[model samples]
Target: MSGSGSRTAAARAAVGAVWSSVTSACWRHWPTWAGWAAGGFSLLYGLLGLYWTAGGDGFPFAPVDPARASGSILEGSRVEVVAPIIAVLGLVGAVVAWLMTRRARPGRRSAAALMVFGWAAAIGLTVIVPDYTLIILVAFAPLLLVFAFTGVPGDQGGIGDILYWHRTNLIIVFVGGLLWATATLAYRRRARGACASCGRRHEEGGGPSRQTLLRWGRWAVAVACLAPLPYEITRIAWYLGHPLGVTPDFLRMMQDTPGMLEVGLGCALASALGGVLTHGLVARWGETYPRWIWFKAGRRVPPTLAIVPASIVAVTIIPAGLMFLWTSEARGTWAMYVPSLFWTVWGVALGVATIAYHLRRRGACRHCGQGPQPGPEPRTSLDQRQVRDDPVSAPGQRA
Candidate 1:
């Protein structure tokens, strides 16, 4: 009778837990509404952009004066027909993801669809508008917001709960944004410095060095924190130079050229650094300062903080690296046909780093006895006399 009663109690406890989880996940109103709104906007923009960029005869929606356009849409005389179209597709994906957030309601099907649609848009944008990665960047913006607000799989509490639940997912989105933005920035700077009219490259002291690689790593972290700043600056600078139509030729040339070299190196370095940051710092540091540090006290750090940032890096850098190969090529028939080989190599490196980072973070050391062990057995504290009496037994033996 007692055993049967205990079983019934355990069953009730399990059912209660599931019920709580369902309730937490289901509680919603605002997120659903915002998602629908964003999704709708995405669909509308995608159609307009695609129509103009792909279907229009020359430059779609060419306006005499863009600043004084009718209706809510901002008027622009010139638009990159192909690039803008690709961006519109990405926006469409974002809308789909938003709709999925509410409609699918955070189940396996919903998350999976979100990921698939997001990737499809990203790949399509990459192929159509290789030089302009902003579309891909825009696609992730809404997804990141979703991640920040959503609940994690194992999370079993309300908004005010101890764990932020989706913190790790948020970090991953951030890292992905950082890498893509860094790469974009680097491409921009390279274009500026390599402008044909400005100067020619010196043969000496040109190849990448160790210090250069280190700087690239720093660029990754900095850019991750302040994503899109470089792009905005470049855009602003371009606008300033084109004022009053005094230098149409010069503006056209500048726009045609790629970005600065520093930004490119920064992108590459950030890509590499993201791998290290996610896997190395989070996995090994776990509240413990570096061994070489002067301070000797042992400390405990929050696991989530360490895990999330690095996980984000691991997830994003690999994809960004792969995309970089074809996207980096100068526009031409030959450049278009060339395979994305270098980017693929870098992606492999990033993947390895990501895996290693997680492994180390999870305490999977052979010498440390930190990996998963046998069943949970009761532990007892003993006095000095008992320890002396037992001395030491075999590895599996109990006291």
Candidate 2:
């Protein structure tokens, strides 16, 4: 009897140790952490948001109209009560999935699925509310959740390695945003007969001209970079006007934070300008090497180098934009929630740029490529060169 009891205790301890080790390994990777954060934040935020939206006074944004009031927080409630609970469960499940990935456990696929569902739920809540801030946050949540699950590098085949890939994508997004903003502004300016970029219209039978797009894009980048400076001024005003938790206008004032949008917009503009200028430099003057430059590669950069960054920007911007659209309440004025507009505009620009970059990289025309054209039958699963040199499988491949 004594021997049997000791054996049982030892088995339990061994199991606990294995579980801890597995969970630890899973959390070490960034993608897993991203997924975990997205899942957890969404689960918590959504359920809480849903509860309040449905009239739980404990959470903010409870239905305020006395005519529609339910006597209790849970009063007159339907299955909407289950919404937050479901969100929490899904987020918890995603965390469990991350753990299982490291442990090589059986339920990882289900966990990943649950995380996806959780993000969907979060996005749904954002749309239901549509307050500008929540819309912006929720719009970005899905991308973050997917990234959280897949971006991290590990022995697990979860999402594969995407660290560098994500970074470069960010750069491309920056470029795209600049160009799109410029184009939009220029189009508006041309319509209004202001600004040289849009001073004249394109010739007959012409779509958006290349030079027009480029010129407009440059101006867009400049405006976007400057857009955030005003917000910074607002933040300074808020700091001076309000004391912590004391102002009569607390709720109204809270909505006015300047935040980091300005910095992000600026970085994006600079990056786009740099990419275009660098390419132009290489095209015009022959290889002009700086003192720190080690290689003589000039501007003929490898396709992967460009594609990876473009992909990162795509993955980040789209989800983020979606999260914003989902979370926002439709009540506020445009000026009150200008960030949403900026994000939406920039997000679309980044997306277009991503598609264009991939199309051009695939041996299409550099100046006019939009994307892969529709055709009858497809060739192989991948191009020959891509298969031969894929970093995932090729011998001595660089990450």
Error of 1 at 359 (Å): 8.4
Candidate 2: misplaced stretches above 4 Å? 1-292, 296-299, 322-336, 363-399
Candidate 1: residue 341 Cα off by (Å): 4.5
Task: Tell me how many clashing residue pairs each candidate has.
Answer: 20, 31
User: How far is 206's C-alpha from truth in model 1 (Å)?
Assistant: 50
Per-candidate RMSD vs. true structure? 20.6, 19.7
Q: lDDT, candidate 1, residue 306?
A: 62
lDDT of each: 0.39, 0.39
Per-residue alpha-carbon lDDT of candidate 1 for residues 232-273, written as tens digits (9 for 90 to 100): 333344445532222466556655565533433444455444
Candidate 2 overall lDDT versus native:
0.39
- Report how far residue 317 has shifted in candidate 2, in Å: 2.5
| Total backbone collisions, model 1 | 20
Distance from true position, residue 312, model 1, in Å? 6.1
Angstrom error at residue 200, model 2: 37
